[model samples]
Target: MDMLSCDLDRTNEIPLYEQLYLYIKREIIEGRLHYQTKLPSKRKLADFLEISQNTVEAAYEQLTSEGYLEVLPRKGYFVMASEDLEYVGKLDVPIKTDNVKNESFRYHFHPSIIDTAGFPFQQWRKYAKNVMDERNSDLLLLGEPQGEFELRTEIADYLYHARGVKCSPEQIVLGAGIEILLQQLVLLWDAKTKYGVEDPGYHLIPRIMKTYGRDLYPLQVDNSGVKVSEIARAGIDVVYVTPSRHFPYGTILSVNRRNKLLNWAAEADGRYIIEDDYDSEYRYSGKSIPSLQSMDQKGKVIYMGSFSKSLMPSIRISYMVLPHQLMERFRSELSFNNSSVSRMDQHILAQFMRHGDFGKHLNRMRKIYRRKLEKITEMLKHYADKIQVIGENSGLHIVLVVQNGLDETLLVKKAETANIRVYPLSQYTFEKKYEGPPQIILGFAGIPEEDLDDAITSLMKSWGI
Candidate 1:
């Protein structure tokens, strides 16, 4: 009801605005400030606390940037409820604050979602401010067609060390998203470059392929990852795969399959593999698999990765590391094409990576996601007799095939009726529909750590488990 007033220590190293920002943030997070509560105006707070309006504005801006508060234009600042914990359950528990705001679902088990609750927005905001400063005016102009060289260099180095992807900065092409990069590839290559995709692959692949009118073949995926036999049988020229962690199923491509695929790529003149190591850093266990591009002796692998999955989706930073031939061809053919991503954002990201903030944030997120996975698996053991966890031993999402003879649609419906959303694995397929037992895909990343038990409990009860 009242404005935030904090005692500022002028002698302290931290700025006055930051002190006020922390105090207000604590009030909101600790539930001292009620949801939707409006704070005093910048001028009013400045006078009340005997601080400059600029200082008050800076504090509010920081809070707004970090998503702890919301600015409603002329309406002044209002609280965007950070009060959290998603649970449509039998048990009664007080809600805890999470990063999500303006929420809809009680529980959304979206496979593509990430842990936004723990994102390093503070660091990102700082970088963003520095990038936009007048000193970096060059970033305001059009950037290189492929992306900022500085950003690409950072990406190239990160990829080499983390995923064993061997590529120079010149080969890396940055785009707003994987879709845009895929569309670029479609436009660059000949129309007859038929593409083969893993069945139940990342949903974005088939859509991009068909949209561009490329001949699309649905390659089946089994325990060893995508079936190379199907690729050869289909006489496909290019293969798109997620070798590190397969989609929905989460199976890693076997070493034998990897070699066979490489051989297929090498055998033909135009054959190539597109490896989408989107969430490679989130691997929970086992030896790190070498990327397809790293293993390629020939210039036949086009490696693509995204910050959308590993980091916040809003970043919209995705990259492609092309073979030498394609890189040269791209430079010659698409020279006029400008960078899809904002140069300001690119430079900020480059700085973030160079300062090791990106790596540190990624490491912390991996640990958080890993813990969420463990908790979900452990909770599922309670329903072990009723559900079969069919997912691979790693990644953000898990697959559960119910013992009950219901179809995939019914499984999803049951969960939705109980205020929980569970995706059917069949929905992920492009051509070949899943005809197995009742199955659903649930991502642990979207669920808050404190809400897992109740969320799982409610979901199982909905299924009559």
Candidate 2:
């Protein structure tokens, strides 16, 4: 057939039969040739392509054996594997290749990156299949305005048990991510509200607030996290705090400051605190830290959590627990906005939690990350004199307070020269400059346990530490 357009490269090392087989296989898998389409006869194809008849016959035989085609009596080979072809097509996803112009590193310490090798893909696939069954047709339609009650119920239960966060499923709102939820919150709150954000904190929160023209005060951070007294001085209406383990620096908020921050929000009617409990799941030493939401006596804290770090980031499932007042306000004002997350994903995650897979996965990842952190500390013991480690008590990353005549910029550049990428703590700041000691952040979660030696060793060589 004219559609079987293939140029035979006789000079190529691959035999003509194998090449023809691969070409026909790709065409069938990619839907260029549909199910039940008849192929040219072996002799006819050989003549058209100026190849031997045996070559065409061998190709057709291979395709038939692989279930890509079927032959009927007196009829030619026809495409027979539609369902199998779909599965094969899905596996042929396009992989992105790196740009030759850009620099690629052997070791990268990206703080937000997580190891997906531990993901329960088999279990997730099972739940996904269950959710996609024809019986669950309701998932195809629009779900509840605030995510599916099933998923919210699971999230509420998990938070109550794991993080001591007290909230009903009704108070939880689900979205595609923290960014989407933050955007919705900016729309709900007053435009004039001055938000207080940590100076050396997760930069995205302040950036998101600024995008909506919300006034922001950069609250300087110390070893004990953000101070509540700073909020009073700035006249901030709201503040975003990471109480469990501060982002980048990993400073845990002191109990007294937590109480004072709660009091600060309670003192004013409109004042509230948004606790972003990002990456608190893996505490290497002691028990997992309880959330700031657990200490709120007044309805002033909006507790937000994401699966981006604890689970797979690509899932894009994030939820926020609203106080009764804000929950009521969201219902009355923001009810028109539908849930940003997919109903199918919600149902699947609910099933995953229902089967206790999520809890098990968290426990497994904790042990895995704990081993990696321990390996890192063990390997870096030799360089202890040159570098001081901080924020390794919890979370996936640790900050190395380094010296030996190297500034933050020089440290990063030196690591780059050694084919390793390390982050500087100053990158987290925007308005106010980071006045702390020169610190380089190394995220250990994505790094494998076996390579911890080489990675840390290479990094040390890079910095001459």
Candidate 3:
């Protein structure tokens, strides 16, 4: 009983029961209490803490309900075998608290967030139960290496109808996330392949290539996506791009450059293009441009997309559409690898797509994000004299190019002083510093719609614009 010490604050507004429960939970999480460790009886704890037995009983009941503690008939409450908690406690390095500090900001303009409030949890739960209810023997077995065939079919059908991508189910490869799929793609290619990435492209693409020890060149981007001419100049074999809507700048590849890039891939023996169509689903104004994979007549474009942005990041589901030329190689060489995603999750998502819940969710989110973007654009009107907005017509984030001549570092530091967080556009640039006007990327997807105006106003006030 002396092993567990809880200092109760009778003066604090929080209920004594809740404080005691939290204390025990923390002990369990931090590994101060080992698995199956006996806890003091309610009466014993009440006597030790100088509290009523009812308070101790209530705390134990809550902990028991949450699976942190278990009671065996006449025996005392014991901590469950929580492997997850033990692993977290054993980590040698400090857990990153960058995400934890997100709450400290009065206003957050984070770019890579989605509204989880609207997530179809109940509907997903229904499908999840259905998958288990059927108890199909097929589900019990390890799924195909590429992924469940039905899921690939559903993804293929959805891509064709939504993004104008034409592909057979056999062409799609599912992984836990795009990074895993990219690693597999890298393994499929020769080690000597020189990859070309857009100057201010998605940061992870180049980082992934570097992880595989491949040589990479950063091609500069203009009004129309990546510079296609630079591919020939740099003598690169592969180019990775976000052609549908470029990151930071949000420039869609013009028809001219799209054709030129395709030609470059076709002309060279080993040249290929990797089209990352992340966040292309949220185009607000004009019609969403068809994917570069849809436009490629030659078997050169390798299309990759993920549900993390559109659905939820925690789902860890992403897929890639391989060109027929590489599909053959992937089958013969790498088909033996096990799928990184859970088979149950794959089937549940397939059900979600087939039943049209996914499409409905996307439509609902598109509207919500569109309204958020509109509100952000309207509120930032107060700063129109000091800031020029770009890339507002599409995607989760909009670029605010400051006209006041403040450098990127000072602008971000100023925002932080006001408890506002703004992301620098230059951070996305690789190798070279962004030579354009000082800009910040404000992502509206994560921030609540009601908070958008307040966040923008905070930024304006912080900047003194």
Candidate 4:
């Protein structure tokens, strides 16, 4: 317990008290300090270190606040057995060192069509001011774990009219994002729930399902969307699908496939379907497809929607329309966990929807995206002989199917060397072998129309077209 013997270096940039705090925390994490070990009196340590008693006291206070130590009346301080010191210490460290060396640090791409500089900050500020001016004390506190009532109701109304989704505000369970809601669904249906994920799908869905220890059935999808017959034949307990606009491929699920899938879910008693309606609002081609939930006569589909793609990713507000029978169960389980969307953002979003600004914003973005898509299409036409650009009829990204057995990995690396970001279709496929031609999934939504020509030129050169 002699502090001087421990070599306390005061010359270091860190303060004396903070240094002491970190030293003790590291000792606990390294297992050098065992549980229930009594420490020498603070006064004694202060005397040994030639430091003030207050400094030792301050360090102890910080340790106690962080749950590293506990104080018993007349018994002094003891190391806390409840604290996860080792896990906490290792949290900030990198998870995988090998991957860090091979891959670029930048993975998430910013769409070209999205004008971040043009966000309606002034209008948003006005709305925020109005909310604060008419503050409700109840609203200031956590209103509901599901969501603020007004936002859910507004969303219900919006979906019913716009997307043809049938549901009441009560059916809408709001959360931070689709990932959180998906995890909740997996936990809800924990017993032998086999999730049928689209092969070559959004990579996150399969990863998340596996993280939760759920069995996944990789369902193959083609130009017509997920093979509904195969899913039914496999007898999956739960099916996760993107019907509006399929991820990475941009193929809309055919109405025939959609109907069959619904019928299959209905036939399999106690089975459910999750329809991820992501990026459907910004369709550049024909009318926006009706949601899978809208076609459900059996009420078995759980529709998942997010504001991230349409609005901003950081907004983190997503919702699901649950079946009537499962509503009570969802509420009962979620009531204990501190998982709820922010009330302030919810209020702002609800007001945006109520005032019809949400619709206006969508219209504005759609026009911008359409114009950008046109310019990109014109540029790609020059290299049509080497690459076929598909899926430009809708969505923010287009698929460039390589012809003549081109090496897609080399194209990706060459594009990276030229400071252009492009994703290979192979990255999304779960199976080792795929029947489709090699393609590159190039996103145009995150780039500017002015830069489209130059970017496309660089990409074409990289492909040696």
Model 2 segments more than 4 A misplaced: 1-104
Candidate 4 C-alpha lDDT tens digits along 1-465: 333244565433345676677777778777777788877689898888766677788878888888888889999888876455444645232232211121221222333234555456766777777676555545667577678889999999999988999999988988898888888887788668788988878777777877887788889888999988888778688988999888867789998898888888888677898899968897876778899998999889999998876777678899999988778888787667554787888888888888888888788888888998899888888877888887888778888888745677776666655645566787677774775567888777767677778778877776677
Residues 1-465 of candidate 2 have per-residue lDDT tens digits of: 444788865533355677788888888877789888999988778788877778888889988987899999898889975775434643333333321112235777878778879999999999999999999998889989999999999999999999999999999999999989988888888889889988778767766876888898888878889887889998999899888988877888899999999989999889999999967898877777789999998999999999988888788999999999888889999999999999999999999999899999999998899888888987877888888898877788998988777888888878866757778887777664666568888988877788889999999987887
lDDT of 2: 0.84
TM-score of 1: 0.77
For each candidate, the alpha-carbon lDDT, in order, equals 0.82, 0.84, 0.84, 0.77
TM-score of each: 0.77, 0.77, 0.79, 0.76
**lDDT of residue 6 for candidate 4:** 47
- State how far residue 216 of model 3 sits from its true place (Å): 0.7
Off by over 4 Å in 4: 1-93, 96-113, 404-406
TM-score of model 4 relative to the true fold?
A: 0.76
Residue-by-residue lDDT tens digits, candidate 1, 67-110: 77888879999876765422212322324332223223578887
Best-to-worst ranking by lDDT = 2, 3, 1, 4
Model 3 CA lDDT for position 202: 75
How many residue pairs clash in all the candidates, one count each?
0, 0, 0, 8
Candidate 2 least-lDDT 10 residues: 94-103
